[model samples]
Target chain A: MAQQTNNFSNWISQQIEADTTFTLSDAVRSPSRSRLAEGIFPTRKDEEWRYTPLGQILESSPDMDSRSAVTPEFINKLKDAMPQAHTLVFINGQYSENFSDNQTHLENAGLRISRFSQLNSTQLQMVEETILNAALTDDNIFQHITLGLAQNGLFIELAQNVDTQTTLHIIHISSAQGDTSFTNPVQVVRCGENSHLKMVEQFTSLGQAAVITVPASYIQMDKGAGLVHYKIGIENNETNHVSNTSVRVAESGTYQSHQYLLGSKLTRSNLEVSFTGPDGHAVLRGIYLGDENQHLDMRTYMDHAHPHCSSDQHFRGILNGHARGVFNGMVLVRKDAQKTDAQQTNKNLLLSRDARVDTKPQLEIFADDVKCAHGATIGELDPDALFYLQSRGIGKKDAALMLTRAFAAEISQEIELISLQDYLQDKIAASLNEIVNASI
Target chain B: MLSIKNLQVSVEDKPILKGLNLEVKAGEIHAIMGPNGSGKSTLAHVLSGREGYRVDAGTAYYKGLNLLEMAPEIRAREGMFLAFQYPIEIPGVNNTSFLKKALNEIRKHNGEEELDAIDFLSLIKKQMNLVEMKENLLRRPVNQGFSGGEKKRNEILQMAVLNPTLAILDETDSGLDIDALRIVAGGVNKLRSADNAFVVITHYQRLLDYIVPDFVHVLSDGQIIKSGTKELALELEERGYDWLVDKAETQA
Candidate 1:
């Protein structure tokens, strides 16, 4: 097992050594480089990765030289999901200026959107400070890998009191044909005081591409600032995706995140949020729907280090065929964090006998005047509900579809974007149609 | 319009309905009154094609077609409706959309063009008025957070919308107050026509006071022991079911 772990680390180290296009400064890369030098990867014995197996990702090689072409029509098809938003496209981790909208307009509006390669000295210093100050309690080796070797990413900064009505949509398309390709994209968002920003990050592939995507994001919210962030993953069946995101909220700041993991052979998402000052709030909602031989894992950590802060999290999973899902969440209230309110809920629905889910919701409260509650449930569709629909003139398959859609609608309806909500609902329905047809 | 002969049924290896027989034509209402565990609900469930019921030896025919061989949805599409005693509370399913889908499915099955959104809303509004149902109920999930009376009214609302040929009321008056019962019975009376039939199943004869039944039958131990006009309900109500049960046992 130790030998296998070394080989996986060595594979990543060799890719970093072979890449000549690496652009980050040595100061930003040295810490991760020293950590990666240990040449260790998580094994099944590790508590953090007990349920997620890294065999497929370790066995495949990421060919850096191979690149797949993407057509304009394909990008347009994705752009239709949010037509009113300003769009940016990335193919194989490299930003495409030809496809992205002009950034001069946004710059004029006091929103600075700069690529990592184009970051000025002050912006680069801000990125380094945000990374250094992140209070992540569950940092892992994959995060170090993305940090050490990433060459493509974005740094978005909004000036004080600048709230834009338009949303920022970033699209990442992984299209690798000859061999398994790897791409790591890091994003950092710095919201100034009294400002608000809405951004969406979408990851999708071109056809059935073999790839491994490792992405990381760091967000910093100043006092009285608000950030609405959305991350959507709809990659192909042969893709393996792992992501890490850390957030820090200051006083009176608000952070809301919605993650929809819809496709991929194997996916593991680790998210951590910490309250840096009192009166901060965070809301997290997500859904992971898997089918066939897919495996999906979601892990979250809420750190309430200040007083008078609150966090609410609700996540749901739907698995069919031989899919496996995992939800491991923890909410921590420090001794000094008085009057903290935290609630966590995770619910899962299994459509087939072979499908499985392992959920663990935990709360650790140290303050005496705190309200913390957590709950987890895993079950199949209600048989009585199915019969009721069938007795009302709906066919068996259609009845199953209706109940399953309703299960997801509870969360999808909470999305503030109507177009995105409808798009996700339609996608969920299409996937459920396949599962119902195959099983029934 | 409906016929049954020796309709014996069992649930989980226990016989619930043994040799039950009934017959009804168009433009008629039959009331099946019995005590608890007398197979009133079993008959209704078996007729509606609910699962977990085994047909030991019997047959049910609707319009000369075998009802036992059809699925629940197929039976529903063929104009058979059953108003549940305890309606299901299905969260997240919108009431209006569910009814619209059911209506469209039945219409499509009968080779009728599906109703558009506007037409469906208009029809549902008219049916809601006929049933005196609150308009707010249409915006909530089906039967979720509904009061007992509201659930019964929703069933009647659905019945009015679907417009079935043969409808079965399975203890629809079990938990209703006097006013709710009157309103429900009034909805049924308004929907009754020469082309439709109703089979009202209740433990008491109070429901029969409003929706007068043309035929009343005593169901004791799963079989029809007595058959008469609506006045039989009045006799059974005054004397109770024990006398009728004793008379049937002596006759056996």
Candidate 2:
């Protein structure tokens, strides 16, 4: 039983064939599916890994279990933000249509949002059409996990010229505690030509158990369209968070993402955006706070595929108590993509003797007329500054917390929602206080 | 109000200050003039308790208390100020915040209440114009991207606000132009009174034209070889330290 040769793909094929929500074809027989599984399923030799070895996670083969009941505490958090916006709530990856719905009201019949468990044949066809019509042609790893094992998720659509003023909130709460309980959540958002959508997402794990949640999201921004996306990851240390989100910006469109990961035992985030047409712009920012042997890993790719586009990226991490971090960012400029302006910077502060951070900023530029600059700094708390603060009678812990909060101030204030920003600020400050106190 | 007796120091085991002695009573300006490598800055570092300066044998007194017995900030609170020749640059720490912290620390040490933010801001704004400094520098990081003259003027502006009983300007006129030097010295001149003493350290006699010290002392090999009136500074400007070196050699 320890060395069983029964691959999950064979089981996956049988499971889907028996199920009524999906249909299999000759395409499923190909090796691409297994290869994608092997890729996202961590092996010991992966370089993007090494620190976060998944051998421990795959020991029992965590599969989504029976749907978890949403608690009143989580319900209140979701209701506080967007009481009127069409919301989608998922408890342990199963979409709850009673509390949140996508197709309640729409300007046009074609524009809608629905949970994965309630999708019709036409909705599956629409997914096939969007995947076929867009630039994504390859079978990716995260997508493989989404289709093969994920139980339930969300699907969103915005028809041409349909602008929604309400903010769409996707709230994912997990209580995966016992054996063989892993949750994979998927969200697909598509904005038609000249359409607009605002997304506010929150990922939280209830304070019960050690669970792993892998969320994969795809957003398609059409020509002359715009999207404002903010993601808050407040998973406690018992949760291992893995998310891969990609956006395709059409001609002259605007897309932006703001990410905040307060603390987790292990976190792997992959964010990518492509400028599919000219005159596109993207703003990306991320902040992570790690302590007490927690490991946070993030890799981002900003593909400047079109001419006359601009992108800005800045990420900050505060680590303490042997916590390690990795930030790998790549900005790719194609040959014909001229007059592109891109800037990237990563700054991390190590607050303990054993804390470490590895940051690599990669730029692969083929064009000659682009302005690209990237720099990273890894440093400790300045003694002079600490002493300066201590000399003012501010306790050492308060001083350290203040400096850590100041390190993340510019980006935390960038969050559009005032309450969300303050919430994150308090969370980060509390984490810093914990680190400072434990050191003493 | 201050005294230093047999103050000896070294850098990397090589002796720099050999029994340097100096005294300043209240309401007096004492100028310590010397050649390029005469331990003038080493004296300032030792007095300020900057790390890595070996105080071999020395004693410094301010208002009859053990001056070097406390941390730099505490020494500063006891009305002893050393205007750094090259101020340290601290990025992300607001200049106004830095001054406010230092001011409050000094005030708290003296058993006085710290001023509120509104009062502190108004007080700093008043000093900003006194030193001909733009208020913009106060908003940015401390001493970051400041020009040589601006850094010097900022130091004096701090001196004006702290209102120390004993102010030591350690080559405050080193890199300043004529206009900046005159304005800086004018600011110091306004703070001059019977209660506060001054120590102006310099290698050149040009600053003497504005500050006009009451006593001029020549520091050679870390000891004051001679003490004279302001006319001696004029004489040293004409004859130079080379003349003094020749006279010491012939006398030896």
Per lDDT, the best of the predicted structures is 1
lDDT, candidate 1, A1-440, per-residue tens: 24455445678778778866656677778888887877667889888889999988888767756666788999998888788899989889889989999999998787999987888888898998898787467667788889888875699999999888879999999988867888889889999998998898999999686889999999999998999888899999999999999999999999999999999999999999999999999999999999999999999999999999999999999999999999999999999999999999999999999999999897888899999999999999998888889888999999999999999999889889788888888988999999999998
Backbone clashes in model 1, listed as residue pairs: none
Task: Summarize candidate 2's per-residue lDDT along B1-252 as a digit string, tens digits.
Answer: 889999988899999999989889999999999898989988876776566677788898878887667666666777878787877666656788768877887788789999899999999988888899998999987788999999999889888888888888889999999999999999999999999989999989999999989999898888888899899999999999878766765775
Please tell me which predicted candidate would have the highest TM-score against the true structure. 1
Across all candidates, the chain A TM-score values are 0.97, 0.88
Poorest stretch of ten by lDDT in candidate 2 chain B: B67-76
Report the Cα interface RMSD of each model, rounded to 1 decimal.
Answer: 0.6, 4.1
Candidate 2 global lDDT = 0.77
lDDT of 2 by residue, A54-164 (tens): 543444345554434567766877566556656777777767666676555664544687665567877666654454343332233445655555455567888888777
- Judging by DockQ against the true structure, name the best candidate: 1
lDDT of 1 by residue, B1-252 (tens): 899999999999999898999998999999999999999999999999999999999889999989999999999999999999989988889999999999999999999999999999999999998778899999999999999999999999999999999999999999999999999999999999999999999999999999999999999898999999999999999999999999999998
When summed lDDT is taken over every stretch of 10 residues in candidate 1 chain B, the lowest stretch is B125-134
TM-score of each prediction: 0.97, 0.84
